[model samples]
Target: MAAGQPVVVLPENVKRYMGRDAQRMNILAGRIIAETVRSTLGPKGMDKMLVDDLGDIVVTNDGVTILKEMSVEHPAAKMLIEVAKTQEKEVGDGTTTAVVIAGELLRKAEELLDQNVHPTIVIKGYQLALEKVQEILKEIAVDVKADDKEMLKKIAMTSITGKGAEKAKEKLGDIIVEAVTAVVDENGKIDKDLIKVEKKEGTSVDETELIRGVVIDKERVNPQMPKKVENAKIALLNCPIEVKETETDAKISITDPSKMMEFIEQEEKMLKDMVDEIKASGANVVFCQKGIDDLAQHYLAKAGILAVRRVKKSDIEKLSKATGANIITNIKDLTAEDLGEAGLVSEEKVAGDAMIFVKECKHPKAVTILARGTTEHVVDEVARAIDDAIGVVACTIEDGKIVAGGGAAEIELAMRLRDYADTVSGREQLAVRGFADALEVIPRTLAENAGLDAIEMLVNLRAKHATEGNARYGLNVFSGEVEDMSENGVVEPLRVKTQAIQSATESSEMLLRIDDVIAAEKLSGKEAGGDMGGMGGMGGMGGMM
Candidate 1:
């Protein structure tokens, strides 16, 4: 290294954003993403119509869906997206709330930075606030039990009320509770995957029905087979009914037409024998996981047996659970004892598409909700809503705890956290107060989305929470009144709130700690011109994160 000579360190193409610039850029990007989905917050929240590059449109108020559909390119923005994704995966709801809180945390941290507060102090304050928030949440939470059917129903309805399925939420809530209850194990744990939501576009949302057994999006293999079978004896087969082809290619050397005819006859015999075995098993309805030979379909129809081929492996497993039928991989192994029984096996046309319905199972561990709507988009949204409802209900059962929604939980958290900040002595107390203020964004955003005076609503909400036993009181968007969320039947799983705060704080802390961003120069068609003017070469860097 020579004095007065510039040292060549990092590559010329690498882009480095250091110190305050890095933090500013990251916070700005995070705020932009937060603002993007901010409008889709509460019961009065509006839906976003996102159109992709191929012109495919998705109209949804779901936060995670909107974020995932958008082509987000900023690295820090993607981290915030991970917060929403984690929320969705953990609690199946509250993605928007998580992202919004994270954004507000970043915004507040930026203000603190401007005031000469170190990032470490802010991070420490957030961690303290997070711990206090969790303790306060447990204190404020209302306990729910697996047997509290009405409370569970309210939890489901709260999750569904803001989205596309609000009109049908009451019925959907009942269906969700029933489906989840049906699959609860002896240990009282609910597997959400056991409840399948099958959607179709044809009828109104109110017409959705719950099937005690599984529903397959497949019709009978042949139209000639019976459309409906009563007291169906279902045989679940994982193997194909078609003649097996030799794995190694071989020349048969059929020099004579008679010999070729004999070969064809042998193939027919094999197909007939497969059908005979199914008939001998006394299976009136066959759900095959593999392909069925055309000749075999003819024989099944002749035997008065309805067969559906190429069923998905997941559906097969679900059918076994729903119908109490053992899946037989080999045709020779099938018998009456290997068959599952259902009250009815029918092929019904929903939204102009044929689907197989296995209904009226006895003690089915898995079930399906046939969700119907008038349009493709409507059905899609209905499915999303149902999914959210199911997720919350399962969470409620698993944790056996819930809290008031409509921002009641957030308000309670904010109030208690501020009081908690008073006991602290250091500058970190300021950060704790900031964390409390950040949480108020939830109720504030709710009021803003509902066209109410945000300042007045926050003031009113705070005043209400200032009183004892008024913790459950929150802003009711419909009447623009602050009331008890529990009495209004607005409730959510406790996990939604706790997970949101945990995720937001952790993500904000991670972003605050990043004071430097080193990104490699991206290779693209336009940059091929070789113009490396300043930091312009780092433009449109989407994957650097």
Candidate 2:
């Protein structure tokens, strides 16, 4: 009976590809994404100028930024982008390495697939190799403490050396170290968020400086307010200094001119009372997160208290941390204990704009880095570079471990993994060896980008790693010779390497497991109209019946 029955068919608009075809498509997508960012790696790498649909331009070599700016439509390729983002979020640097490694892993897996190795077997080998690499990384990593200023500077400099900030890496590195060090609490907890970066487009990148306290890109609300307040007792207020309207709608109607005058006087008295309360609390400066009425500003100036209105909530929180002050919401609740003391609270002109600087804070737990560059693009890139530096430094402080960079660590791990693969006794061993070869891609890319012979560099690096006490030797891009990366001050946080490997392996495995791809057709206006017409036809047919 079933032989004579009709078979159901999928709609023409729905497309599905399975098995080899699907895997090939996904692998191709992954490879293409990797190739897109491959050229922008290491110090010798070139930058990518990405222009969006609206013609806005972004010139950057940062991996995450480049990937994010690209309008990738493939689902599989997007997964690779996530790998870069995760690496960037976790380690701040090494995003390019992570994406490139993931791509290489997939390329190697494709080779294994061609040789009749099962995807499961290849993935198992990758997992094993990843675990082994982490162990190797830990073995080679050096311990760093909170007070190790020299080592911290090296870590920061290493993170900044390859990017646009390289021209002033040393100076920027010092500022980064000082900013992070100043914000580290006594308990050794380093919060990268406590360090603020402000960028202004007017000077060279080297003009960037670190400030010991918070810097607000705002000025005194009233011109008559003191530009500089010495022995500042800052009051951080969240509530509005303006008289709030009633929560429920109401109206006041005055039948006489005298009544209207009394109403205006009452409002002024309320504003004056708010300012009086702030003065009585012993606060000479006010940072208001909400709006301050004009009357309140007048009274505050008359009282000789400097005030800034509508400050960002984040800035208010930072001011509290930096000044050791409490944020008060209600004027009635304001007290002397809520006031934060600063040696000087001043409004100064920066790049033709007035900026408030709260300086000389006692033992500030938060600080700022004012980054200056000659153009908007330069300043933006410098900010990105500084952010990476801060992130790596914070990660190192938290993890208390560092690794040699410039592909040195990758070479060591690849060698160690190859040796470990020999201990295995199955076809999976080939996959493990494939994983080892994938690790070599990092150094190879570095060599290629630096215009050196990739093959020669790899051979020399392998030979050097085989020798005793030469495990940390890496290709120094400038010298084009293998050198000890650690001694050369090319160091990075251990988390960068570990996270890159972990994310790349996970992304590759996820991609390798995709054997089917089904895409739903996107509806256009014509299709939507046809569907609507079909519905109308059905309605007409019912009416005729």
Which 10 residues in a row give candidate 2 its minimum summed lDDT? 536-545
Model 2, global lDDT: 0.88
Per-residue lDDT over 347-430 for candidate 1, one digit per residue giving the tens place of the 0 to 100 score: 988878999999999989999999988988898999999888888888899998888998888888998888899998898999
TM-score of 1: 0.96
Best by lDDT: 1
Q: Across residues 371-472, which tens digit of lDDT does each residue of candidate 2 receive? A: 988988888889989999998999899889998888999999999899999998788899899999999999999999999999999999999989855667
Give the per-residue Cα lDDT of candidate 2 at 383: 92
TM for every model, in the order presented, reads 0.96, 0.95
What's the residue-level lDDT of 294 in candidate 1? 92
- Alpha carbon lDDT of each predicted model: 0.90, 0.88
Off by over 4 Å in 2: 1-6, 526-545
